[model samples]
Target: MNNAIGNSMYVVIAGAGHVGAHIAEALLEQGHSVAVIESDMKRFENIEAMDVLAIHGNAASPKNLADAGINSANMLVAVTGSDETNIIACVIGKSKGCKTIARLRSPDYLREGVGTGNLDVFGMDLVVSPDVVTANHISRSLLLPSLVESGELSEGQSLIIELRLSEGNPTLRRMLGSIQLPPGAIICSVSRNGQLLLPERVGPLELGDRIILVLDSRMLVANVETAFGVTKGGGTAVGGRLETGIDKIVIVGATKTGIQVAKKLENEKAMIVMDTNTERCQHARDVLEKAIVIHGDATDSALFIDEGLGDASVLVATTKNTDFNMLSCLLAKKRGVTRTMAIVDEPELKLLFEQIGVDMAVSPRMMTVDFILQNILGKQISSTQTTLHGSGITVLEVLVKDTLWMVGKEFGNIKFPRGAFVGSVIRGGKAIKPTRFDTIMPGDRIIMMAPQDSLHKVEKLFSYHSGTWRFR
Candidate 1:
């Protein structure tokens, strides 16, 4: 039933929603041969024409699948608006002898699929639930400073980690070889300033050097805290790790996302939520259950002092008002909070968080974009995050695929876009801030951060790769 023709594997996407388009864009940009088969004719016309092959058709029907050439297609991702359409598309793709992936939005499928009798009946490779992925990312990112990135692989046998050297980081100006990586950790790449860099044997790591590493599952949180210069000791940085944690956290807003932030924590950290609305603050209190909710202004210094806001380990400002969130986080930082988080939705005000001294600025919109890109795109883009200031940097957690042309090269040999830096690498379960000695491997997950304008240059890291990445 699957009769598709292409020089190599072709990916067929069966939806044109926000997430589907994002996936298509990424695949097209990363040079993947993707045929988007959207049922909506009007929406199909709106799909961006930047080098992607767009075929308007319905994959839900068997006839349509045959017409769309599903026989030779490698992978089929069903992400249409209707769950029935997605499942039907997957079933047809499987019948055509192609690997199948379906976006299962219902939590029922997520909970019952594995043990629930019949998911294996179809040729399902991976089933993604957006809420689960989004919640997981949000919880993890909320726990650490913006400088460190972490990922899980192989059920704990291996990991991918990224570290960004900030202006005030204690590891600044140190020789790459001098710092000892954790046991079972390997460094992958170093992003210095905004360039993907390969440091010399004697090169010293200055502030703002970004490092990506892979580590063994046994690594503890205390070790991570120590490695990243956190005041607290021994706990890992994944889900459920921070709840048993004994640090204090203050969230300066009572929005829905703020509630999500609190729900993610499973630790004993004292949480105080502050908001201007009496009812909203009360709702935050009731919803958090374990947190102390204060109905007061976040910008008020006296209130901050009285509530011990400055003494918290982390301060998260998730107010809808970007300006207020940034300012509140700055206030907390000045009061000596160790870590801070702020949610800013505006792309234009990206610089405000940095200028205002917030430790990290998060945008749900951008994160949602990355989440949508995960399933529809063929490229192995694990996750994407952007860091502010220091020349408009962006970090992409991309799986190294065989189609990449720049594979098996040392960091120093890779040509980065001007103003881009290749910081450090995570290899074999350890962090290696490479001194121009490390090499890229097949299974390696590379974390590269570069200037916002230099993303095109960063893509050159895979100049010869076939899979497309719709980079933002």
Candidate 2:
């Protein structure tokens, strides 16, 4: 979660696209009040279905925001796909004493400094770029790929992975009693096409069953591959766009994915190409950088044991050979390294990594498509996956205006949405997990969580703003 988020703020979100809707859902899950202003009829109808106070109107107009209960709101987030639209909504919302944040894609907005010439000029608080985020995800995965992607759904001491079913599945039709899950790990849920997966002690698995499981980070990938049906050595053969580095990253691969990761991360990154091909590495170095290049079979585990990876905090592996990255990560994990990451291109490998344990894995093509589709008119995103990969959640810091509507209301009485988790409360800067008997008074900022579906209802539950929707 971004540091800017807290609990307890009346929020007005403009646009319900991938980022916008994702933010709205996050805010909703926190139990904070949110009113979404959408200009598109279809988008409005869709958001309305989520049970939020969705209004169909022009977000570019101050009246539209006011209608969504903005004047009395504590914050407003503009996530319209168009940078200009987001800027306009945030500018107006900020002027009304509502803290505002906008989403922009221009790197120029994030220049080394902050001021009138940048995002600050528009009264925006945050600037997010799907491309940059996607690049980072890809880079992190390329570094390790062994552990699947990170942060799917993290509960304290636990993580979830979305694994696809593959051929020769050893655990097929076997109950949890039969399968040997790595120590310190347990199967959490088995996600099928569209269902809420619950732990079934006697559940039977079938072919093509996509399992979502969790395991200890210390488990070995090789063991996981053996338990599941994977290529003899987890072959490489990655395929993606190719480019050079903008940051000084030393990737050890010459395959398509290796090239793609390089291309996406290109710009100001002085990348050091490492491979065993003296001629090819030299050629790659010639086109990318003329720095010291290492040429040797990276599959040799002794090399990593010999030369310590540089001070670089990030490592990427897109080598055509999966075993190379996998074994490399196992060695890295043994060194007591905390932030080791990996990228497994195989869709089926998603769950295998979880059964073992890897930091993060990302599907370039799926993420790209999801990111692009998330940019729509008014609303930011639509699906549940996008919500997690997108903003997913928000923290609201709100001052209770000491009104009768909230003064005596108990949290349980509010019955916050299913997904919302109330984290804490702030009384004069000291934070505390609000007690059940906690009575809200004036000048109190309570943090909350609500699903996107509950955003509208949350707004009405605590909204003192005049623009707040009054339902029967």
Candidate 3:
């Protein structure tokens, strides 16, 4: 998990589009040697300009992959726009004894029992689906309007929320340890002026600083809002009071991303999907029986008025066209929609959308990069560890195997390394707040937080296996 020289890996990436290029840049920043293969000459030039080895050739071609050093690569990432090309390149990479990962766009590839083998058996160790990732993120953001970002751990029993400190907040100018945190809540990391700080030695919170908090339940979010003085009129923070629970949802576009979002929200709200393409509208209508699909351009202001956009609790712009998505969201905001979110393809456009009055702007390429990085680097550790970007910490979700070192021992008796702590423990799918008196048992998944350098020691502690079950 640590980016030590001994842990540096050789990674080959196929494709030079936004998703592929972003992944390559991230891997290089983490001290990994990276090579990218792209067919487009312009994209090849862009990758080459980044000071990495760039091969201008078809990624699925054996000669192109060989030129990228596939034989010596530790892993191959296929992320071309075409699903077939990605799958073909991964298959080739797998044959060369390299671990392969594919960026699959079609849900059919992920469908259970689809006649094709599982990802691993199909020559891919993992599959990253940006559409699904974007849809899930939108769903969570819709549910928690106050949270800047939300991620769940411990089988969705524990939650991580990111919120920004603004003026008039109660926690400002106070020592980290002095803040009255709710039960089972902790401030894990802080971001100040684009720099990360651990709570141990960090100074008093400052306005505009982003803080990440881990809690045992979503119920604690209200406490956080009250402590930080965040309200519906707060400045630059997504933390706000929703007038009502999500009841009406309006989705623009019937692209794959739009369709996926509609599918996720259709059951929870009264859904209306709008698209310019008649065929796509028909397809969405057929698939989403509960949703009302309209054949019209989402960017048209007339259409928004006709649909009564003001009544929508949540308006999502999922169209692939960035301009259309941004314009539609602006119109929705003008119409007094409670919340607006747009799926921006370009990272730079996010800031532009925010300045133009959009409530939230998400980048699919950025989200996909995070998903691939976590999965690829996580699989390297025999005991997986996910490196929380920008936070100098690594999180490991490990099962309490039947090892004498851990099983049947009280939490306080075990000697945990410095900078390592058990965040939460899941037993039988129920979250348990770890206490000194609690005894470890087999089949328990313990979520641990550790500094990067100490990850090896943390993993070594749970590496062994004694029998399957153990009683305390």
TM-score of each: 0.64, 0.44, 0.69
Residue pairs clashing in model 3 are: none
Alpha-carbon deviation at 377 in model 3, angstroms? 1.5
Instruction: List model 2 lDDT by residue over 108-180, tens digit each.
Output: 5655322112266878655555444455556543332233333221211223333444344556677746766
Local distance difference test, per candidate? Answer: 0.62, 0.50, 0.72
Write down the worst ten-residue block by lDDT for model 3: 463-472
Ranking of models by lDDT: 3, 1, 2
Model 3 misplaced regions, further than 4 Å: 1-6, 112-118, 153-157, 163-181, 187-212, 218-242, 299-302, 379-472
Better of 2 and 3 by lDDT: 3
Candidate number that wins on TM-score, 2 or 3: 3
lDDT of 3: 0.72
Q: Which stretches of candidate 2 lie over 4 Å from their true place?
A: 1-9, 16-69, 95-97, 111-122, 134-150, 155-158, 169-175, 191-206, 216-472
TM-score for candidate 3, please give it: 0.69
Clash count list over all predictions: 57, 63, 0
For candidate 1, lDDT tens digit of each residue in 333-402? 7887767777776645655665556656666545555544553343354444445333465655556666
Candidate 2 lDDT: 0.50
